[model samples]
Target: MSVDKTFYVTTPIYYVNDKPHIGHAYTTLACDVLARFKRLDGYDVKFLTGTDEHGQKVEKSAEGFGTSPQELADRNSANFRELAARLDCSNDDFIRTTEPRHIRSVQALWARLVAAGDIYVGHYEGWYSVRDEAFYGEDELVPGPNGTKHAPSGAPVEWVKEPSYFFRLSAWQDRLLAWYEANPDCIGPQSRRNEVISFVKGGLQDLSVSRTSFKWGIPVPGDDAHVMYVWLDALTNYITAIGYPDITGEFARYWPADLHMVGKDIVRFHAVYWPAFLMAAGLEPPRRVFAHGWWTNEGQKISKSVGNVIDPVALIERYGLDQVRYFLLREVPFGNDGDFSHRAMVQRMNSELANDYGNLAQRVLSMIGKNCAGQVPQHGEPGADDREMLDAAHGLLPKVRDAIDRQLFHEALEAMWGVIRAANGYVDRQAPWALKKTDPARMGTVLWVLAETVRNLALLTQAFMPAASGRLLDQLGIGPDARTLHHCGSHHALKPGTPLPAPAGVFPRFVEEEGAA
Candidate 1:
C-alpha cells in the first residue's frame, strides 16, 4: 500500500505501576479491531501499544516494592507485553518510554517547543495527584475526609511548590478552540468533544511541564535538576513510536495518526495538552482522539480494594478468547460505560454465537457433508430468497465499514448478526431438508446459497474474531489469499465441487459448573 493508503491507530501506553486489567485490554482490543478492519480493506496499517514507565507513581511504587525503578518497570512492562500476545492483539509496534530512541525523540521535541518559545522557567504551586500524574485546580477537587482534598478521580492530592518549566497552554486557548471548530471530528463521540471544549473555554492555564521534586521522568533538555512532566513525556510516545524528529521515514508516512484510542478519564491530556504540544512543535496533531467509557464489574466500580478487577487472562481462560473479545465489543456501544456480568457473557455466547451463527454454519456444512458427498454443493440458480440473502450478506461490508469508521463496534457486530439471524430464518423458511425428498436439486441450491452467505459472513467477521473466523473460513475451504474484504461479494463465491473439511463447531456453548459463582 502507498502512503495515501496508510492508517495509524494507537492505544494509550499503559502505566507500569498497575497490573494489566480489562480496561487495558478493552482499549487495545478496540484498536486491534480497527487495525484489522483497515488491513482487510487494503490499508497499510500501523497499530502501536506499549508501557508508560516514567512517572512519580511508578517511582513511588518501585520504592514500596524494594526495587530500582528500572527493574520494576522491566518486570511489569514484560507482563503488559505478554498480555498483548495473550489477547491476540495484532499490534505492529510495542514501544517503551524508557527506550533510548524514545528519550532522544522526547528531547528533540523539547528542543522544538523551546525554540518556538512555548516553554519557559516558572514557579509552580498547585495540588498534584501522584496517582493520576496530573495537576488539579482548586475548583476541580472534592472534599475528602479529615479536611483533606482529593482529585476528581478520587486519588488523594498533595501540595507541591517548585521551580519548573511551563508550557504556554493558556496562549493556545483561542487557537485550540478555532481548531476544534474548524475540524469538528478531531475529538470523538460528540460528548467528549463537548466536555473538552467546556474545560478549555472555562479558562486555560499555563501548564507546568517539568517536575523538580521527582527524578524518574525525562529530564528537560539543558536542565539537569528538572525532569519533564509525565504527561508531556508520555504523550510524545505516539510520535516517537513512528520515528519523530526525522519526519522522513515512517514518521512522514504515518504522522498525524489516524486515531488515538484512550479511556475517558484522560481526555484532557490527549484532546487538550497533547495537541497543543504538537502544534507548538511544528507537527500535526492526530486526526482523532476517541475516549471510550469505563467498565464496571457486576454493578460495582472495578477497584483493587474491591478485589474485583477483571483480569483479561482469567476471562479468556474461563470463556474462550474470541468469546471474551466478542462479548466485550458486542455487549455495549463504544464510547459508553458497560457492565460485565457472567450471565450476559454466557447469554451472548450461547444464543448469538452458538445458536445463531454457529448453528447456521454447522447445519449447512453438515448437510453438504452427508447429502452432497462432502463437497461444496453445486447450485442451479434464480430464486428470490437466494438473491435476497446473498445481497444482504454482500451488502454488509459498507454498513459495517460505516459503523467502524465512527468507532461503533457494537453496531457493526449487530449489523453482521442481523444477517446471521436472517440466514437462520432463510433456512427455516426454505426448509432444505423437506426439499431433499421432493426436489433434490432445489435443496442443493438452498444449501449452496447458505454456504456462500456463511463465507461472506466469515470474511467480514475476521476483524472482530480472527481465530474463530479463520477456522470458519477454513471449514469453507477458503484459501488464506482469498479472505480479504474484496473477496466477500458474489464475484468471489465459493467454488462448486471444492472439497470442504469435516464440519466441526467453531463457537462452543459455554456451560457453567454447578458449584461455581
Candidate 2:
C-alpha cells in the first residue's frame, strides 16, 4: 500500500446504557493499533470512536437509575472516555448520537432516501427485542433452554404492532450481491463475507427505519409520531463526525470510511443495512466492514445477572493501561472469540513484555553504557553471526507490515517479537561482555549489531506498545520522529557517538505470591 494513502477507520460507537466492558475495549484497542500503525507508516489516518447516546436501552437504563437520558449518557460516555484514555487509544473523534451535527446528518440522509422513493410510512408488526433494540423475523427465532423462544442473536423478542416508516431494502438485494461479488474484500473475513452474500441471496426484507413507540431517539423529520430506528440513528455517526451535509467539502473527502470495525453479531446491520441505506441515498458504501469476535470471561459468557461482566476500568486499574491493551490484542486472533482470565493476563505480562522485550532493552543499554563509554558504537564490519542477526532483523519488516495490513494484530506482534528473540539469542551467543578483553574490534561489531537490532525492534513495537517503545527509543538516543514504521529497515538508526540515556524497566513483571494473607 502507498504510504500516502488516506485511511479512515471506526469502532462501533458503543451504546451508553451500561458502563464500558472488556468487549468494548477490545474493539477500540484493535482500531487504535491499526490507526497508530497507519499513521506511523505515513498514512493520513482518521480514527473515530464514541458512545451511542440515543436508544431505548439508554432511556430505560436512565429511568431505572432515576436519571434523565442526557445525564445517563454523560455519565456512561465519560466512563468510555476514561477507559479509552486508559488504553492509550488515539481516536481522532468521539461522536455522540445526540449531537446536533449527528441529528442533522441523519435527517439529511433520511430526506435523500425519501427523495429517491426508497422510504415510506407503514405499519411494522413483528417480534421486537428491547434488549437488542431490533426486530427479528420468525425464522431467526430459536427455542431457548429456558423453554422460551429468543432471537438467535441473544435478544428477547416481544410481538409489537405499530405505525412506522420503512426502507425498501428488498429492492437492493441484487445490487448488493453484485457489489459484494465485484468487491470480495468489502465485508471482511471470508466467513463473514459468505454469510452476508448468502443472506442477501436468500432475499431481503424491507427494514423498519422508524419506531413509533420510542420517544427518546432522534425525531423523524416532519413526523411527530415516530423516531428514527436506533441503528439508523447510530450508524450515521460515521458521517456526522466528519462534518457531513453542511460541510460537503470536508464530508466528501472522508465520507466513505475505509473500514468499519464492528462486532460480529451486528455485522448484518453494518454490511447489509448500512450499505443498502448508502446506496439508496446515492452514496458509496464504506470501503469495508470488519466484524471482530467477542470475549467471554474465564471460558464462560459474561452476564450481569451472573455478576461476571468484566468492567474495563477495573481491568485497567489492576493491570497497567498498555499492559491491558497488549494483552487483549495479543491474546486472541482478531476474528475469533477469546476467553479472558486473570491468570492469562499475568502470564502474558511476565513472559512476553517483561522477560522478552523489556529484558532485551535493559541488557543492551547496560552493555553499551558499561563497555563503550556510554556512547553508541559504530557498526564497522559484520562476521557470520552479526550478518545472520542483521539478515533476521531485515527480514521481519515485510512480514510485520503485511500482518498489520491484513488486520492480524497478534500475528503482526508475533512476527516483530521473532526478531527480538533472535537478536537476544545473538547477544547471548556472541557474549559481548567476554569479547571486550580478548577481541575489542569483534566486540564492537557485536555491540553495534545489538544496538541496531534494538533500534529496529523499538520501531516495530511502537505501534503495539507506544509508551514502552518510546522509552526504548529514548535510551538509544534516537529521536521520536526517527522511530516511524518507515524507518524499520534502515541499517543505522542510532549514530555512532550519540550519547545514550540510562534505560529503565519498561514492563515490570507481575508476580503472584503464596498465601501471605
Best by TM-score: 1
Following a full C-alpha superposition, what root-mean-square deviation does model 1 have from the true structure?
Answer: 0.8
Residue 446 in model 1: lDDT:
94
**Per-model TM values vs. the true structure:** 0.99, 0.96
lDDT of each: 0.94, 0.86
Q: List the residue pairs that clash in candidate 1.
A: none
lDDT of 2 at 104: 91
Candidate 1 accuracy as lDDT: 0.94
Q: What is the TM-score of candidate 1?
A: 0.99
Per-residue lDDT over 1-517 for candidate 2, one digit per residue giving the tens place of the 0 to 100 score:
4634888999999988867888898889889999998888888889999989987888888889999999999988998888788888999988888888899999999999999999999899998888888888899898876787799877777898999899999999999998998888898777898889998999899999998776899999999779999999899888888887764755676768999999999999999999999889888899899988889999898998888999888877777887888899999988888999999999999988899888888888888888888899766768788888888886777888898877889899888788889887988898989999998777878887888888888888877888888888888898866777778764545678888877677889986657621
- Error (Å) of candidate 1 at residue 29 is 0.5
**Whole-structure CA lDDT of model 2:** 0.86
Candidate 1 local lDDT, 150-264, one digit each (tens): 9999999999999989999999999899999999999999999999999999989999999988799998888989999989999999999988878999999998999999999
Report clashes for each candidate as comma-separated counts: 0, 0
